[model samples]
Target: MTLFKVAQLARTAAARGSRSYSSGMFTNAGYEASREHARGAVETWKKISLFVALPSVAIFSYVATKDELAHIHHLEHDPPKFVGYPYLHVRKRKFPYGDGEHTPFWNPLTNPDPEE
Candidate 1:
């Protein structure tokens, strides 16, 4: 339609969109209500985790491992010697630095020594 009518319509639309139901000023009542709700939720979740979830997990773990624990036994003999099979323990090239005999973080308990 006319430019004046279009401008008036746009102004009216913008005013309606900007209108708010709540007061623009901050209020202590709103802050207190939100804080109380958040505190109650935190306490409820803490109680559920402490009294319910933790104990349930502990009981489940114990029951599940009880049979395995009873049957567990250490090996009577030492581990088998590392037979020099090309495909099995393939060490293509030695390390660039250090003695290059064993890995940098080699643990005798877990990892077998190359010389063994």
Candidate 2:
């Protein structure tokens, strides 16, 4: 028989004061109550997931759009300087043959003293 028909029979038997009928009715009622609780829990979880997901999606979208916003606003930034060994040494060295050609290093004979 279908669950509904079984529950109906159990209820009728319980009303007649039969021990067997009482047990069946109580079991059916408990099952129905548990099912309701499970459904409510699932709904609660769905609401919680939506709350969590919406903010995460909004944050990700905002981060992704930052570059586009910067481009539209014509934002410019200088390139980062290299902090590693070779690049640091290269930057520190003054090019003797370049703009400052009169520096002592460029004319070794004029400043023969190495300390100079």
Candidate 3:
């Protein structure tokens, strides 16, 4: 039989005090109204996410990168001078692998000085 009919039978049985099949729970009286409300909420949130949240995130991302992009452009045009100090770039003992001085992953363009 249908769930509602089963519940009704369980309620009737419980009222008679034969044995309580149902634990005093029943279906929501406003289930259809609640479901419609939930559907409306979902649609509203979807619109908000697509129109408001998406654009806000994209604009924030662009704004965040704008200054960093300008700084990168400036650095590319005029890089800071490399200073030569005794402690800096020191090689008191050679590394166990790969020419002992320069690392295998070292790039000449970035770190140009590899000892004269």
Candidate 4:
């Protein structure tokens, strides 16, 4: 009925070279093997989950602002500037950074650019 019981019966059937795992369906683990398998799986999962979380959290915590999009906008486009660059002309001038503006025209003025 339980997974470990199913596994153990399958193993037994496979060892006997039987044609079906279900052929040994009545050969349940009689409680002991099922209990042992469940206990081992829970203990192993707890240890693995704890171990995996440690490195994952530590690695992500140090990620740079340069790697994220939000910080870069505050630097460049918060205040639009006027220039004779022949691009960003009059009326076309817009606050180009903070609100997810990462284009070439906006990036140069964006505060705390993510790449720097």
Root-mean-square deviation of every model: 5.4, 20.8, 11.1, 13.4
lDDT of each: 0.73, 0.63, 0.77, 0.61
Judging by TM-score, tell me the better candidate of 1 and 3. 3
TM-score of each: 0.46, 0.35, 0.48, 0.34
Question: For candidate 2, what is the lDDT?
Answer: 0.63
Writing each residue's lDDT as its tens digit, candidate 1 over 29-90 gives 87788889999999999999999999999999998798555544221235445566657546
The number of the candidate with the highest TM-score is 3
Clashes of each: 0, 0, 0, 7
Could you give candidate 4's per-residue lDDT for residues 1-116 as a string of tens digits? 99999999999988887654463324565566767888999999998888998778777866754466555565445644444454433344545555543444543553333334
- On lDDT, the leading prediction is 3
Question: Rank by lDDT, descending?
Answer: 3, 1, 2, 4
| TM value for model 4 | 0.34
Candidate 1: RMSD to truth? 5.4
Model 2 alpha-carbon drift over 4 Å, by segment: 1-26, 63-76, 86-116
Tens digit of per-residue lDDT, candidate 2, span 1-116: 89999999989988787644445435878889888999999999898889988889998999889977775454334323334454422335555665642453543332232223
**What is the lDDT, from 0 to 100, of the residue 79 in candidate 3?**
60
- Give the lowest summed-lDDT range of ten residues in model 2: 107-116
lDDT of 3 by residue, 24-115 (tens): 22446466667888999999999999999999999999998998788777767776567787677777899889878877886554555635
Candidate 2 matches the true fold with a TM-score of 0.35
The 10-residue segment with the lowest total lDDT in model 1: 71-80
Which residue pairs clash in candidate 3? none
